[model samples]
Target chain A: MKTIKNGIFNENPTFVLMLGLCPTLAVTNTFEGAYVMGLCVLTVLLITNFIVSIIKKLIPENVKIPVYILLITTAVTALDLLLKQYVPALHETLGIYLPLIAVNCIVLGRALSVASVSSVGKSLLDAIGIGLGFTLSLSLLGLFREVLGANTITVMDGISSFTGYHAVFQVFPENSIIPMTIFQKPAGAFLTLGLFLAFFNYIKEKRGAAK
Target chain B: MSLFQLFITSMLTENIVLTKFLGICPFIGTSKKESGAIGMGISVTVVIVLSSIITYLLYNYVLVPTNTTYLKTLLFVLVIASTVQLLERIIKHHFKQLDHLLGIFLPLIATNCAVLGTTLLNVNNGYSFIEMIVFSLGSGLGFALVIYIFSTIRERMEFANIPKCFKGAPIALITASIMALVFSRFF
Candidate 1:
């Protein structure tokens, strides 16, 4: 429980650690892309952590970093092909980012810091915690970008052949200037993340003061 | 597209950092110091140019011939990581002054998304050898250009009053957003 909370709130990958900013910013233009990206990271994180734990003793010291990277690349490659087959649109949306996950510092950072040293079960727990934290942060950022930039909330828009494909909701009336189109652009991504980071810092200060 | 147009587009209009959102980690982390930004920028440019050449050859000659293109991501990253390591040693032994500037950043460049991202883009775009060289050179210089500009702004920002909560990364990010806005107009 503490591990999960630590991952989600304390060492949140996006807001706190500030690792993996590439995907966090690039894909958050839409809620769905960000959400899927988070889940993909979570999956890769879990797989890498699991295998690293099991093979920790067998690996040599000098070759550890490259070995860990190889493991991560393999996992990301498998996930990439699967996404390409099952969800072509989401795969297209993610584009280069899906493969870029292999290099995302958060995954390699955890593999070095926690997974390589901890027990298998503990590493798995940490993975879940950190993964959830990452997912939550990405989702929140995505939600903010989608709502403010486009004034819409999209959830599982076209995962299947269901009737009326999009589950999108309009937040503002048509032609309302309240929705800033800039939020969907790269600048908006930076601005939104900055505000979110600042908000988190303010909260942390307040809590520190209370303590 | 012509080589000159490709160069311009890669360097400015489709900047690797400002527009494509690659290498944000180093862009924010290393940009606080101007010298560090230059060091990182130059090192990244060298690595990007070198790795793009090797990866392009491997992709066309090796991966395509063998029908194992799926291995490009894994292979490209490995090639990049090894290339950075090799480049560091050569620089250390041969170019002392150059190494002093880029030594520290060389290791970091291996994991930089920008390096891998550019290599992948080259293959994905199917650029010819000369086009690949031009594109990578332009992209690297573009990265250097943006980081240098950002470092100068951040240098001045040292004196600017900022909220306590927004003192560090937040304010820099906001500043970058503004910079990004300005750069986006070039297209």
Candidate 2:
């Protein structure tokens, strides 16, 4: 429970650690896209942590980085192909990002930092915690961007075909008011991220003062 | 697209850093100083060109023949990591000044998404040999150009008054956001 809280709040990947900024910025243009990307990262993180922990003892100290890279790339590639086959829409939305996950820093960072030194059970717990942290941050960022930029929040779409339903919630009717179109652009991503980082910093400072 | 157009497009209109957002980690982390940013950019340019050519050949010959395109990610990353390591050693022995300039950034280039992203984009786009060369060159130049400009601005920003909370990364990112807005106008 502490591990999970540490990942989700104390060491939040997006706000605190800032490990995987590229995907966080890229996919958060839409709620659904960001949600899927977060879930994908979570899956990759969990599996990679589990396997790296199991093989940590076997890997030689000299070749650890390269070995970890190989493991991560393999996992990312397998996940990429699996998504392509089963969830083609999400796959298309992710595009090159799916492949780029091989170097997402967060995944490899955990493998090196936590999994390599910890027991399998501990690593798995850490992975779950970090994954949840990343997912929540990504989703929140996406929600802000999508709501402000497009006045709508997309929870699910074509993926619903598999489950026989579609989901989208419009915050305001079309033409109701001018949406801040900037929130949908690359610039908006940076601005939104910067603001959130500042907000988190302010909170941390306040808590420290109280302490 | 013509070779010239492709070069300009990749370098300016579709910049790997500002537009595509492939290598923001190094762009932010290393762009604090002008000299370091230049060193990092040149090192990344060298790695991207070398790795792209090598990965392209491997993809075409080894992966294609074996019907294992799925392994491209694994193989390309390995090639990139080894290439960075080899380049570091060769530079350390042969070019002391260059090695000193690049310092630790040479090895970090192996993990920079821009390097792998360029190679993968080349393969996925089915670029001809000449086109691949031009694209890689353009992408590297684009990265160098953006980081160079950004670092210069950041150096000046040191003297300017910034808010307490936005002193470091927040200001840098806001600057990047404005730059992205400016760069987007070109396209």
- What is candidate 1's lDDT per residue for A87-161, written digit by digit as tens? 777788899999999999999999999999999999999999999999999999999999989898878764443
TM-score of chain A of 1: 0.96
- Per-residue CA lDDT of candidate 1, range B16-40, in tens? 8877899999999999999999999
What residue runs in model 1 are displaced by over 4 Å at the alpha carbon? A161-165
Query: How well docked is model 2, in DockQ terms?
Result: 0.79
Residue A80 lDDT, candidate 2, scale 0-100: 93
- Report the Cα lDDT for residue A154, model 1: 78
How well does candidate 1 match the true structure in TM-score terms?
0.97
> DockQ of candidates 1 onward, in order?
0.90, 0.79
How high is the TM-score of chain B in model 1? 0.97
- Judged by DockQ, which candidate is best? 1
